[model samples]
Target: MFQLVSTIVIRRLLVAIPTLLLLSLVVFVVLRLLPVDPLAMMLPPSATAADSAALRQQMGMDKPIPVQFLIWLWDAARGSLGNSINFRQPVVGLMVTALPATIELAVVGLVLALMISIPGGVIAYVLYKRKRETAADLVVTLLQSIPSFLWSLLLILVFGVLWPVVPFSGRVGQEVTLPGITGFAMIDLLVTGQFQAWLSALSHLFLPALALALSFAPLVIRVLRSGLIDAANEPYVEVARLRGLSETRILWRHMLKNAALPTITMIGVQFGFLFGGALLVEMIFGFPGLGNLMVQAVRGNDLPLIQGISLIFCVLMLAITVVVDVLYALLNPKLRNL
Candidate 1:
């Protein structure tokens, strides 16, 4: 097992090197090719020629595009991604400050997705099992077909505009003031014993998380339900039944265990969607996160910030891929043995 894990880790790292290189090259080329210059955008239009020269030199933009990318790549390797043009802070510092919010949102969204998916999947499978074409199944199918952003709009319309049950946008209420502990508002509030602030933050979080959950749950439900149906028809399930195992035990312990692999794979794949979905959702609802930061950076032509965020996102996706591979091996021990 240890040897297999080591091999997988090494192989994944090897694969990630080329993937990151290609990503960096693409992002650098694309950003440089844009008509706007970061320095020009940052400086006033009335600035003289010497000022422009000095700014370009300072930003290393006076160099050839290839050389500039090389320098940026070198700096990135050293964990210094330069500074953000818009925020006037180190790219690393900006990412550190903003990443916690995005992470918190994504984690909450994933939890909500799982909570909705697991039960819905079992119920769907049961309906399919009994051959009952119910309204619940129709609802699930409709939800599966709709895009996440549409759900965001629907959530905003229903919960924000009409009923006003949850806060429309933002990560916390203005009235709830608390010191930043871990950068996550809810955690910071809870650690400081500010229950009201925590509740406020949670309420603010619900709408976006719900949007993400609604978007992801249908996929899980479909995948898990198919797995369950297939696993149920296997001869081992009948053998387990003949061996006096309860139906519930056979379903959950035996069937669900085997059925979980595809769902787990789907969850791994959906991590990217969660982050990508959060980008639009954050933009829609005015949530201050990495997504918001990226939008601002793009508008301001902040190359450093854009490159740093893109690189970080690419690394994160690669990391998720590695994690999924490991989980796949662990769950299907046959691969590990091989």
Candidate 2:
């Protein structure tokens, strides 16, 4: 088992390195091909020609595109993620400040989505069990198909505008306040043992999390429900039942274990979706996160920062997918044994 796990890990690492290289190279070239210049965007129109040229030189605009990318890539390798043109802060430091909020948002949203999806899938599978004529199934399908951004907007309209139950967007309550922890506002507050600060953060994060949950939940429900339905009807399940296993035991302990693999695979893809979806939601609600940062960087054509962020995102995605693939192998014996 150890050897197998090690081999898989090594394979994933090998794959990951090349993937990162190619992804970063593509992203770097694409950013350069754009018409905008970093200096033009950073400085106001009233700036003198000399000032712009000087700023360009300072930003390494004088260097060839290939030369600039190679330099930046080297710096990135050395753990220097470069400073942001717009924010005037080290990219690493900024992520340290911003990542916590984003992590919290993604974590909470994922948790909620799992909660909604797993149970929903079971309910949907059981209710529809070979009888595909239920309003509930239709509702889940329709809801899942709808885009996450649209749901967030609708959430803002309903909860933010009409009901006022949940705040529209943002990671913390304006009135509650917090000392910047650099990376994680919520954790910083908790680490400092400030319950009130945690409360403020919670209120701010709740709606966005819900929006994410609503978006991801349907897929979970659909996949898990189908898996459960199939597992429940399998010959092994029947044999287990005949062997005097309790129905609940057979369904949960045995069936759920097998069915979980598909759900886990879905989660891997959904994790990627969470990052992608966060961009739109962050923009919609003014949430200060890496997604929001990326948007600002892109608009200014901040290549260094954009490259840095994109590279991080690519690594994150690769890591998540690798983990998921390994998990898929581990959970299914037929896969791991090979």
Candidate 3:
């Protein structure tokens, strides 16, 4: 089992290297080709041509495109993702501060999504068996049709404004000063015994996470429902029924175990979309995540920061894909042989 898992990890990493290289190259080339100059935003309006030239030289932007890319790549290989022209900080540093926040948000959102989706799927399957699937279908349709940003708005108005149940903006309240241990607020707060701050963080996190959950859960519900329906018709399920297993046991222990394979795969696949959706949701809630950083980078034409964030996102997606493949192999032992 260990060997199989190791082999899969090795194989996936081997494939990921070239994929990341190609993606980085594409992102580098495309960003350079844009007509807008990074220095335009970096320099003052009264700056001279000489000032522009000197600044370009200082930043190594005066070099040829290929040379610039090579230099950037070299710098990136050494873990220095170059400096953000706008923020005037190391891109890696900026990402370090922001990425964890985004990750925490994404993870919480995914958890909430699964929490809602899995039961909803099981219920929908039970309803399908009773010929009452239309209600489930209606609910799923309504949830999926609305975009995440709109959900964010509605959540804000209902929970943040109308009832004032939860804090809508920011990761923590102003009075809560958390030590930056893991960059994850909740984790850091808990570890440091700041229970009050942790509660504040969770309160702020709920609405944005729910908005993400609302957007992502519907698809998982549909996929799991379909998987359950298919698994129910399998010959093994029939045999289990004949063996005098209760319908509930057959559904939970047998059917759900089989159905979960596809549902897990779907969850992994949808995670990329969830990450993207979190960006918009993050912006709506004033969450200081990568999405907000990316927006700032774009507005200021911070080439290095933009490129770094783009590459990081690509890497994250690839990592998620690799994780999904490993999980798939674990669930279905047949793939280990392949």
Candidate 4:
């Protein structure tokens, strides 16, 4: 098992390295090709020619694009992601501040999605077996039809405007200040024994997280229901039935385990979408996260910040893919042979 796991890890790393390199090159080139002038955006209108030249030289924008990319790549390799022109801070520092919030939000959203989707999937599968799948199918379609941003807007209108049950915008209420130990508001608040602040954070988190969950849960339900239905038709299911196993036992003991494999894989794939969706949701909810940072970078034409954030996102996606592959292999031993 150790050897197999080692092989999988090595193989995934081999693929990921080249993929990351290619993606970095592409991002660098694309950002350079954009028509907006970073220097113009950053400099004051009263700045003279010498000022422009000096700033350009300082940022290495005076160099050829290829040379600029090489220098940036070298600096990145040496753990310097360059300064954000907009924020006027180190890109690394900005990411450190923003990434944890994004992670916290995404994780909460994913957990909520799983909480909703797993039971939904089982119920849908049961309905499928009973040939009464209309209601389940309708719910899936309704959820899937609306994009996450629309869900965010609707959630805000209903939960934020109409009922006003929870705090709809921000990570925590301004009055609830906790020391940033882990950078995660909820964890930091809890660690400081700020139970009231923690509750405020949870309240602020719910709408955006629910938007993400609603957007993500439909696909999970569909995938899991399909996997269960397929598992139900397998020969082992027949044997379990022949052995006088109750339908519930056969499903819980036999079908769920196998069906979960594909569901897990689907969840892994959907996590990327969840991150993408979180960007918009964060924007709508005024949540400070990488998505919000990226948007600011773009608006201000902060190429360095954009490149850093894009590379981080690419790396995260690759890491998630590797983890999913490893999990898939662990759960299905037959993959070890490959």
TM-score, one value per model: 0.93, 0.91, 0.97, 0.96
- Count of clashing residue pairs in every prediction: 0, 4, 0, 0
* Consecutive 10-residue window with the lowest summed lDDT within model 2: 125-134
Compose the digit string of candidate 3's lDDT tens values, residues 142-205: 9999999999999999988899989999999999997999899999999999999999999999
Task: Report the CA-based lDDT of candidate 4 relative to the real structure.
Answer: 0.90
Residue range 1-338, candidate 1, lDDT tens digits: 87787888999999999999999999999999998868876679799999999998988898998999899889988989999898889999999888888888888999999999998888888788465747767888899887778898999999899988889778889897757778998888888888988999999999888888898899899899999999999999999999999988898889988899988998998889899988888888888889989999998999999999999899888888888888888998679679
For model 4, residues 12-61, the per-residue Cα lDDT tens digits are 89998888788889999999999988878777889999999999999899
Q: Give every collision pair in model 2.
A: 96-182, 96-183, 97-182, 97-183
Please give the lDDT score for candidate 3: 0.91
Candidate 3 Cα misplacement greater than 4 A, ranges: 129-131, 336-338
Which residue pairs show backbone clashes in model 1? none
- Model 2, position 157: C-alpha lDDT score: 91
Badly placed stretches (over 4 Å) of model 2 are: 44-50, 129-132, 177-182, 333-338
Indicate the residue-level lDDT of 44 in model 2.
Answer: 83
Note the Cα lDDT for every prediction shown: 0.88, 0.82, 0.91, 0.90
Candidate 4 TM-score to native: 0.96
Error of 4 at 338 (Å): 8.8
